[model samples]
Target: DSQKEANGLRTDHWVMDKRHSTYLFFMGVGEYAIVKDKWKNIAVDYYIEKEYEPYAKQIYGNTPEMIEFFSKKLGYDYPWAKYAQISGRDYVSGAMENTTATLHGSDILQKPGQLIDENKWEDTIAHELFHHWFGDLVTAESWSNLTVNESFANYSEYLWNEYKYGKDQADYHQMEDVNHYIHNPSDFKKDLVRFDYASREDVFDLVTYQKGGGILHMLRNYLGDDAFFAGMNDYLKTYEYKNAEAHQLRLSFEKVSGKDLNWFFNQWYFGSGHPKLNYSYTFEPVKKQVTVIVNQSQELPFEFPLTIDVYDNGKPKRQQVWVNAAAKNTFSFDVSKNPDLVNINADGILVADITETKTPEQNLMQFTGSKEFKSRYSALTAIKDQVGKNPAATKLLSAALKDPYFRVRQKALELMDLSNADQLKALGADVEKLASNDPKTLVQGAAIAALAKTKDKKYLSVFEKGVNAVSNSVKANSVAAVLAVDPSKANTLADKIDLEGASDELLSQMLPIIVKNKVTSEMSNIAPLVAFYPFLKFQNPELGKSAEEGYNWIMTSDNLKATESVTKILGQAKGQMGENPQVKMMISQMLKDGLTKKMELLKQNPQKASSINPQIDAINKAIENFK
Candidate 1:
């Protein structure tokens, strides 16, 4: 209770069993407003800052539902006396699962409309909450086996997404995770359960969080739903409040499936990298068969068990085959007729980078007729590489624009050509429709941004509507689109942006537009030039480039006052911008160019150049001092 006692102060004491690790224990006391709720018989407390007290419902109100969902799903009850979450303004990471108490970053405390984009963090909450079971209760035996905890917690994000949203949402998240791991320059072949380490912190990478989660997801798919969940329940029951290694998890699944998981565990957990494959298929009409040749080109080979689907006359015939660890592997399937298309890894059973050498006609069959989302995605990628004015590619992309999956539509929009008016005229209706009516905010944002590439005025109305979108990304894209269609209106659109609350992304996009329109005078009234001028040293290359252009425009303006403002910003940012070579080079070039222009004017009108000598000398001094 918050009531004061005879001691002139209120005291609240809470305790939990000593089953959790030392790192899992947490406590905090401050001027906080406690929001209370319940799940079954367990009490839940959401401790939030007094300023964010009213938003407690929007931030942590769903704790009970998540607890109930996880409890029922894991075949376990709430393990602690009370489940409490505290929103800390100074918290570093997203959130930490501390036995009975979880600490959330202040980003979770959103007010009213802020919940529109901010509520997308429900997955993060789900991730930390799942650690209560995977990390707090059944912990990793050592830092080397961190994947045992982080991977399972990451997988829980997909589980909740699949359970509440749908398989499509879960699949999208899986693909995103795969993309992050694959695109990283680091080696993917490291063993997830190895003792080799640089430090404990090295285990907290994408390999442990994303790639590990992906492997677990694949294992679940391989074991089937019933067996997988049964094995998980057994694993949790056996290791409650205890630390476990990766092999123990393998043993649990092996016991449930009654099969040796040596190939699965050794290749995935102990293996270093995913497969990089190049494949081609041949259809022999006389023999009525399809032959697929796959080549493994990575440092180490991977054994891939994949489903191959052959499409003939719009009908799919599925076959499963294993590709051994060989440089070259071949598989032939007997069919009644020549196959129109062949899909390898149609079920997405393996994580690998696959390239297909198929004709547009063959790919269109999978693009339009394949039942599996992976098959369709692969077909889209194959066709996306060959995107052009080709009628077949255009038709396939147009068809893909209407796909039920947002990712497919997003990819199509990305690959679609809007280089000229004719192309936009052909695909404009679909693109405009998606920009205006797509249910997914990301897809709509992509469509809206694609308009900026066209630079055609026909889609001005679409861009105008998108400017008021709920998503900041969509709004940023809309601003660019408006400027592209009508450069004169950049200042008007930029003026409406809430510069104080604007995200770096929105500011980055708007900055370039404002520079191109030469609207420094209009922007100076909204926000101080110095506040944005330092973006010349921004970490993002694009933001730095835009800021450089903005700086150059202000320096080159005919208005002497604007040019003087540039000098002041350069002076203010001298020491900070010195470390960045790009910013220094840009400033050096601008000063050199400005000094040359002033000298040229001096040859024509000696009196004006004499009057501007002080400004010229200052520019020269700033350039000389460039680090």
Candidate 2:
């Protein structure tokens, strides 16, 4: 955790290798740590590490329990001989099921002496373990066959989370995405099936997890639960210890279900876009029926369930129907009462945008009035921008803000965006208390962040005081809160805080905040000015032209201070980065872009032109590019 590395210390890096039996086997140390516990299991010792030791232990203990749980449920023994889970420190790439070892980003790693929400942590642990059977034991042959790997892993998480934490906690709509789940075309230049991911960051996207998992769940609903698991068993038996692609998996399921499933995968996965619907129908009281015609178009071609809530005298009665085929999926409901409104997915069943038509105001009033904690929580989550104006409108929410659920209390604390600083401080203090009570990291982190944003000096002092006293995780949280409000605090702490012989945790804490602060406050200003999304630096044929143009525009803008920083950032690009060809090209193009800027500046502001090294160097580099 030292602030500076010892002179000549060797920094380790990772590259993909095919030397192992696993789909991806990786090794790295120093800045990149794999913190799994090593154990003696048969001939070869097993080493497993997560972001933290306690979380690793927790994950380890649960693996055997989950293995036993699934084995009994499936009437089959655990497939893998030895299991290990290693959580990445800030796992932007996502959790991977690599043979006996499963790796997840370490941001989810819970610290020792920190109280954790039993449900959420366990669900993540369970989700990865479920992969032992579906992904590790029987691997996907190619990344293109994403359905076999991600769908199974994701659905397994949902089933386990639902069973353990209830259907609400298995909430995909808000926590994840509703649009991608229903296949919205708004962001489909990045296709769900045929991948074009430039980096690992894009692989763990919602299209892979939420969309894939939701479709798989629907598949189970279409086929009986018995048939679904039986199909899984058949698929596993057919392709154990080997890689099978998407078509192979479809064939396996098709055999067990005795149904042609090619159309199912093709329509959903291979297709260009999703279904969108627009409809209107009036209820006739004499007929004692609710007749609603559904209108759809191939704009989305989405086939997901739409629940209609029939309200009579401000009370709701719910029913579900399929909004199938983008063309027009229509059905009618008959009842003695003429319903005031029809709400689609009122309970947030399927993840889709609420754009068809507005639900009844009375139903919303009832929802806001009810004391059901989940209802109040849902309303608060759904109304992000509208809540502040309708504070009185949300009865259950106002009451829920005082409710026992720590998350509920925290959310209530968050809504105190009053113009008065004292009001914000009061809410911040309450959130500080709730942070101790709530074991949820997201809630606690959100509370701390919101409190820090108050920008009051007294609040900053309170946060600093909290950091000085609390245990590591709690202290780290307070530090994070302070950093969010004023990144300079982290820099100040880095300058003052002694890192010499400090524990890895302390260094770990400092490095990320420092890098993040630098990225936002420092480097971001610098990167775009001197460089193009440049071919010499980050050369993707697709993005190079746009990035280059964007950088040129930024440099010519009137921000002189930014212009100075940009020159320095571009200077770094003149040298080598790594063997990655794209990296080289991007650096060159950025330098080239910077050179053009120097030529203009040389005539406009000659002294400033000489002051900026990259600009001067860039002027030379531009000529070299053409030469």
Candidate 3:
């Protein structure tokens, strides 16, 4: 409650509803530009920085629609008094669900140019909003069963994408989620719900988020949407404003669907590791039957439903089979003729690792004949290594450049080896055309990157135009292409590019160029560049190396103005890092190490210490103040 006094001062009071988890309680006190909107008489607001007042609507405008969609989808109304999202400076996490108020990172404040391309945080918005039902209303009983809170929120990204965009976008998002889990083979050893984790933070890993979401997707596919959503609605209602566990969730689904799901809950939730499947088929012309063999190589066998599509004469016949707890299983299907292709896990719904034996011709047939994005994507991945060596593979790669899905087209562009002159000759024109005219900026950026491998000057004009594109990805790629063609324009292009709405892809591309070209004009943008250090250091090592190079250049640059700007920026960063002690220590140590290396260099070359001493002293002082 806020009331203005006769003296012209306002008093505000906040009183949160009872029964909410302490973790979901949040309070924000700061000067904010409150952008007002509403959903069916309920207040929906965005609190952002004053400078981003105009873009407040653009950044969070869909929030109201998202609330409406989630409420209707969950068969529940927005239960709180109001909903507010506040963007905090240097926020630690992406976003958090706090009953009626959510907190987001300052990066959520975007410029008009960034929104022109895409609202990258839309999925995040949906994720946190869905938590209103899954995390807030029905809280997880324990950290051991965090999937009850996080998995649903993670799957909400796919759900919202499917509803708002389409299945392809959702499938692509799911594919990335699956990849994030699978990339670290060690994580596969952990169960979705484990009681023996070392720390509460240990539960918040890929298994809880990505793999858990994939399991829910498979469960949804198995139960069908009607029963799945019905069960979800029932669960939320039963446990609203209370705590629930994974078993209770399963019980809700079982009650709604009238099917015992112990096999699923036992194996997926309680068990560790996924099935490693090797699928092959043998054609028996005499019996007019194809025998499909699936071998599980993992130590423990998994019992799950598997789909196989037998293509005969360019038409598919779907076969659903259950693989029990066995090392090997075989199923024979009577066919009219030799099967054209035997595609396992046909819908690409399963989260397991599958190696299917298929010829190049079969892969191409699957790529063209299959309607699903994952199937087509799998086919492309299968033949990616054969692009330059095999004629059919080369043809498939060329055809995929025009695939209906932008991700497919982008994948094809990524797979193409444009460094080979013959391959470039075959696909250069198509690549250039996509670079110039593709509807998706991501695909266009990829096409531009593919062309950059050639280092040909003829495509300079295309790159120059791309520098002015609305998408940061396109602009960054174009600047890279420009650098490849003419190295002299590095500093000029670096100065022209705006870092206000830059994406990680843009930063990754430009940091190397900035360092290699000694482009010190980007000193004012040092905050974001410095902020990116921790993320890159842990998540992306190659980019982290480039950032290290940039840091070294800044600390030791011959340019006095560049060094002075960095000193000021480091001091400001130290002040801002007060809230994040870990980051402060990390930066402080980095500065100490850098000073050590510079001192060694000065000692080795005594004549250079006169010029280097002042720079070294500035970094030392910054480190001392940082402490």
**Please, what is the TM-score per model?**
0.79, 0.61, 0.86
lDDT of 1 at 352: 83
List, residue by residue over 1-627, the lDDT tens digit for candidate 1.
Answer: 355678677767555645888988887777899989888888898888888788787877777888888888888876777788887765656788888888887767765434543465677788888898899989999998998899998999889888877776777787788779888857575787878888887788888888888898888888888888888888889999899988999888989889788888888898778888888878888888888898898887878677888787767788888899888899999987777777777777578887767777777777777766777777787776567745677777778888988888988887887875665767778898889888876678779877678887888888898788767556767877887788888657865443333445446667766666666543432223423444446656666666666655544433455555556556666755548888777667767777776566556666666456665776677678774
Candidate 2: worst 10 consecutive residues by lDDT?
38-47
Per-residue alpha-carbon lDDT of model 3 for 1-627, expressed as tens digits? 899988778888987765789999999998998999999999999988899999888889988998898888889997888999998875766899998899998768787667766787888888888898999989999999999999999999999899988998999999999889977898978989999998998998899999999999999999999999999999999999999999999999999999999999998999888889998888999999999999999889998899889999978888999999899999999999989998988888998888665777778888888888898998998996687887778777887997988889998988888888778988899999999899888889899999998889889999999998878678878888899889999767876566556765667677777767665666544434643365567877877877777777655544444554456556655644566878778878777776776777678778887787886877788787777
lDDT of 2 by residue, 1-627 (tens): 124458966455433232234554645242333333332341111234523454455444555556666665555566645565555543544566665566766434544434342323565666677776776667766666666777777777777656655565555323454445455454554454666656654555566666777667666766667877777887877877777777776776788789888766786566534445566667777777777776665455666666676666556667788776556666677766777666555655443444553322433544544344344455555554454445332433345455545556556556655334554533545565555555555455445555665655555755676465334444655776667557776666543332222233333344445343332233233344225454433445534443444456545543444454455444444443545666556555655666566567656875664355554654464435433
Report RMSD for candidate 3: 5.7
On lDDT, the candidate that comes out on top is 3
Off by over 4 Å in 2: 1-55, 58-61, 70-75, 86-95, 103-110, 113-128, 172-206, 247-263, 278-281, 300-305, 324-326, 335-340, 347-351, 356-378, 399-412, 418-627
Ranking by lDDT: 3, 1, 2
Error of 3 at 549 (Å): 4.9
RMSD of 2: 10.6
- What shift in Å separates residue 145 of candidate 2 from its native position after superposition? 2.1
Error of 3 at 621 (Å): 10
Best by TM-score: 3
Deviation in angstroms for 321 in model 3?
Answer: 1.4
State, as a TM-score between 0 and 1, how close model 3 is to the true structure: 0.86
